[model samples]
Target: MTAPPTAPATSNAVGRRVSWQTGVSILVMVCAVYLARRHWPVIESGAARLAVADRGWLLVATAATAATWVCSALAQQGAVARPLPARRLVAVQFAASAANHLLPAGLGAGAVNLRFLTRCGLPVGRSATALAVKATAGTVVRGFLIAVLALACPGVIHPPHVPAVAVAVAVAVVGVGVVLLKGPLRRALRAVLADVRAVHELPARAAALWGGSLAFASLHAAVVIAVTQALDLPLPPAQVALAYLAASSAAVLLPTPGGLGALDAALALALTLAGAPGSAAASAVLGYRLLTVWLPLLPGLLALGVLIRRRVV
Candidate 1:
């Protein structure tokens, strides 16, 4: 009699599991369809623009794109107290790039990295702090590069005339107010500050953190330059780099999956404003996206799957 009752319970548990799995599958399918429909125009335009770009320059852009993974690994290593496995770390960065596109505002990448770091034996809190540190370093380096380039080519980068600065200040003030009001956020901030201090105490890690951050931003800008050159865009390389840094940095405020629409629009607009023909600007933007986002996407996804199967991420 007891065996018969247990069998029904087991069957009910299995049924519930299967139902949950089916629901999740349907949700994923819905999301996929939605994203595809929404991004179709950008996809079509990028394809058209890339069809005419010089293939050789595209290869250089692709190469620069590959180097970004190494830079990211180095930066991540600098963020934590313990050293991460170098080979696995680089692979995780590559995989994270693909994951980054699947979710809005970098949640996918952060989740992947958090998993990887925890698997490497760090506690969850420290892993999150490491992410925060790397992000902070990357933002600072991008801003520094933009400033330097703007000074180098003042004629290309016009002064800011809009009330954007005031708006940004107001936003910062509001953010600070919120942070102060939120207890959990306050604790998180304190932990991040502690980790920042710990990481800065190690000279080698400090250098790697800042150097890798700078290199990552520079390589990204180099990718843009290669794309522009491939299209024979007449804009100067410095101007292109400056525009890329500024546009991409600004695009961070509006997080769309890998900055798909936002970055593309900003890049094309910045390039045109920098004196490139509209067609050339579009071509360059398309080529850059092709190398950085589209081309590697499949491989990155495959790598993500492999890492999951191997239980590496």
Candidate 2:
């Protein structure tokens, strides 16, 4: 007779170990948030006034942000052949959003999504493919819009350090475009599309994906504007566009969780370069993050609990 399997002594060790990378990412975010604000009094007073002065505007903006999330859920629907309940998909999306705010490199968001997708009966490969398509679509739409806005707005066009950055970005974009359009690249694209039978079948799925992407990009921009106003930075929409665009680009490219430290630092620096005082820029970055990244985590935790109980992952 075969012996029964024995439990390893160190099975618990894996569960007990702290993630040093996560810890370090958190530490860096903390230091950046704390250190960047030298004139605390100014930042505090400005933030307080803006909060009171523009409460209505902020509310409207927040609603727009929520709508973007709904759009994101719709994008997920695009990739999956079988439809899960919309309400459940939304909860999963919200939970993912919450996690994104809490974790560095956007891992929290990704993990929550993976869990939800798997729970909904999608195989690993399909889930990954779905995620990949959604991500690429979102990136292309957001980046294209931002780039156009940056070029069109004089305020954005004239920002400090922007010229050099723009040239570099232009070169990179051209190079990427060339690569994507070439013969081998075209073949690769054809090969990829060959396997996505489900993705190809649904009518209006493309529209929904694009719509969600556009809405999310707009909401992301609005949040930045709201936070800046809250800090009484007085930055015009143009400058906000450029700063938001550049900072967000850097954050997304960075490998760290949700681009925690990298995002804040880049935004602060970009804002400062755009003529805002350092403290004000820092305050805007910090306050904006509080709403966008941290506060939503509470809802995420609750959603996570519900998900676990439902056995839907």
Candidate 3:
């Protein structure tokens, strides 16, 4: 009799929690879809027509963006310093990209990475730290390379309101650099290394990590330029590269899960100011988002279901 009452209460509690979680996911999805639609009018006006004229370029850009996943996986392999299978690394990268779009801030993305690696045979500490290093390295390399390009091609990178955002980017890079270069960072890392020595020692060749990161950065930069051309926007390749790089780097700072609407806004706005008509820029960015994010979501959802049903998570 007492057990019967407890079962009802427990089931109700689970139902309420699931309801709340589902509600949050739906709310976020709606807002994102709405913002994307708002930008549709711009493209409808002329952007679509312009992009259709040079579909090949857009295809190239889309390909480049897709290739960034492979580059990311290679970077992770370097950071992990273990002989991880290439297939597994790619799986983690692709899955993490999808998870990032849906999860809060970066926790879900990071958690997916951790889970993927650990399940692949790495110990918990090594897996988590490798993920941290890989993520941070990606951020650093992308921002640093973009800053260099922006400086070289000022006209392209300094779109409308770009000066203010560029300043912020510079500050963020410097701040992270300072933390990393300062003695405190080394000390803290050493402490972590000492504790995790049994799991895996942090790699000594910092250059290798940066090299892998650079590859990831460079390939994605190429994609941005490709997208610019594909849209038939009259922007210079150098300028488009700079704009995409800047928008993308700034997007990393956004607290929203996977940068979502925030990233879209940054990319579209930056492109618009770079002389690509608003519609052209918005459509290209929208297309990129759809391909890079939404397209993979279905597969990711299946993976999530499998993982959950298999008790993998």
lDDT of 1 at 178: 90
Model 2, range 1-313, lDDT digits (tens) per residue? 9965555535555334334434543553453344335435544554564465467666755676677678789887776667767998888887677657556676777777877888788887667667777787788887798678777765544434658888999999989998878986666555446535556667667666667777777777788787677557777867786787778887776766567778888888888877889878877776666556554545555566556555555
lDDT of prediction 3: 0.68
Report the candidate with higher lDDT, 2 versus 3: 2
Question: Alpha carbon lDDT of residue 158, candidate 2?
Answer: 46
Q: What is the TM-score of each candidate against the true structure?
A: 0.83, 0.70, 0.68
List the candidate 2 regions with Cα displacement exceeding 4 Å. 1-53, 101-103, 154-192, 195-201
Writing each residue's lDDT as its tens digit, candidate 1 over 224-301 gives 998888778898899999989878876887899888778889888889999999978888887787777766666676
Model 3: lDDT of residue 285: 77
TM-score for predicted model 2 compared with the true structure: 0.70
Error of 3 at 97 (Å): 0.7
Instruction: Give lDDT tens digits, candidate 3, residues 114-162.
Output: 8767877888877777776776777778778777877877666643465
lDDT of each: 0.84, 0.69, 0.68
Q: Clashing pairs in model 2?
A: 104-257, 104-258, 105-256, 105-257, 105-258, 106-257, 106-258
Residue 125's lDDT within candidate 3 is 72
List the lowest-lDDT window of 10 residues for candidate 1: 24-33
